[model samples]
Target: MLFKEVIGQESIKENLIQTVVNERISHAQMFQGKLGSGSFSLALAYAQFVFCSNKEENDSCGACPSCLKINTLTHPDLHFSFPVQILGNLKKSDDFISEFREMMISNPYSTEQDWYGKNENENKKGIIGVDESKELFRKLSLKSYEGGYKVAIIWLAENMNIASANKLLKLIEEPPEKTLLFLVVEDLEKILATIISRTQIIRLKSLSEVQISNQLANHHGVDEAKAIEISTYVNGDFAMALHEVSSQDNSQVFFDLFVSWMRLCFKKDVVGAVAFSANIQKLGKEKQKAFLLFVLNLFQKSLLGNFSGMENVKITPSHKEFIEKFMPYVHERNMEALHTDMSQAYYHIDRNANAKILFLDLSFILFKLIKK
Candidate 1:
């Protein structure tokens, strides 16, 4: 995505643009930000500007061969290393290049969750293992095919294990000539201190609510009032805000399913709960995740509705009725446990865990919590 296409972060964009203009680019830099903050987009745009055959003062010339290649994320000199699960014996990042390319082309603001959904692996932990790191080292060792800078983007770099980080440390210490490394991470503290020291850090702040709202209104075709409400609910997570807008149709379905699941669990209806789990198992990994997220989001709203107010809660009439009745159950005693259970379920689902067992197990936990 071009700098212009990415919403907000104008100052960050200008700083990135000026890096190339001044010709003082760092060989290794970390673009650290929260999920949906557009760190990847910034890195991609920066790489595009660096490799642009006809570079403009503010952005890359989109018509150039280099620009076109980078836009599609197929640039010969551009390589990506991201978290991936072991499919059979294959754990290589290169194995999922086509999907990765398509995903970014469609949504540059995608998170690790999005990547997990794309691969449809059940709760399989995506990591940058030592094997993948060695592969990256091999790829970066080669000279740039186009006779320019080679860009290596390590998406979710914090997912790298110790061995992988060590291997990457070697490369960063003595990187190939004309090579630039972009280590994109969500959590800074998780990364090895040595690795952090080796790279220049560029922070991408989360988008403001207004920025996210405008993006939803203009691009997602959301009405202003709805976009503003969604933005507030999302609390500046553009990826989630966009997701909520795009998946608006599923809102009611998720709501009804959640209510049913809670009722089954609360009533100790094992047969009903098992059947519910079976149905959830059939919804595929992404929808399963969306269901969990929907449930968690509602719990958050209900908690607020119980204590503070529903000023920020965005939902339909059915959800409103449910929350109005359910608010008392979502107390301080159970809110944390409820959120933790659902969040952990979401995480496990991304890792390709068994959905039936997971959902049923979560049902038991919810039953105990709801009893409180």
Candidate 2:
């Protein structure tokens, strides 16, 4: 991806380009940002610029041989290490490298959940282990085939275990000549302090609502008003905005169910709430979890609307209708309780709690809170 292809973050792109032009590139760098904020895309773009034979002042020349290779992720000098689950005989990152390349080429804006869904069939954890770190060290020990820079990009670096993190500390501290490591992490606090100290951290901000809406209109042929609606719901997450706009299945259904649930809560209809919870439990675990998060966001937006008035709020037509009906129940006295209940539900879901029981419990609590 070229610098211009990435949305917004013009100043950050300029800074990265200037670093390469001045020959002051750091051996190890960390791209820390929220998911879907273009951190990984920026890292890829910077790597392309660094290796481009005909790079311009602002971005890489898209027509160059090196650019073509990087675009397909087949460059000999560029290597990637990401979290992967052990499946069948596929024991390492190398085993899944072909699939990884195809997935990225198909969609570079995917998240860890998307990767896990595409690569693994059953529910399996993805983590970076010691064996992968050993492989990374061995690869970096070799001389670059293209005789330029050898880049090792570790996506979701925070998922690295303690053993793997400790093993790579030495290499991160003192890499071989012309070697660069790009660590992409969603949450910086999860990374070990030792590793964080060794790398230069680059903070990436979320795209503005206008930027996301404009990109949605241009890239996906979405209408401006619909794009703006999705952008507001996504809250600066472009990947999610794209998913919501493009997908016709689960997310759309969840939005409808969420609107209905809020309306039920507002009316204090215990029978409807119980029926809604049962329907939510039938949507599968992933969808159930997604619905819970969606409900939490809806509550937040309602509370924000309650305090700031309706003019400042942005929501879809369905959501706005539900919020208008539900606004009277979400006063300051009950907002904290509502948030806490949603937080507890999320915690239970993360711990693999029974979705049926959890949703029933959450619905009952909302039923009580809304009555007050």
Where does model 2 exceed 4 Å of error? 249-255, 270-372
lDDT, candidate 2, at 162: 92
Q: Model 1: what TM-score?
A: 0.70
Clashes of 1: 9
Q: Poorest 10 consecutive residues of model 2 by lDDT?
A: 246-255
Model 1, residue pairs in steric clash: 122-351, 122-352, 122-353, 123-349, 123-350, 123-351, 123-352, 124-351, 124-352
lDDT string for model 1 (1-372, tens) is 678987788998898888788889888999898768888888898898898989877888898999988878899999999999878777888898899999989888898988998888747779999999999889889988999888999999999999999999999999988889999999999899999998999988778878998888888788876676566545457887878877775666776798898788779888998899999999888778767876887788888888886666665654678788888889898888888888899899989999999998988787778864
lDDT of 2 by residue, 99-218 (tens): 888887776777887788886553677888888899899889999999999998888888888988987797887798889999999989889998998899999998987999899889
Candidate 2 vs. true structure, TM-score: 0.76
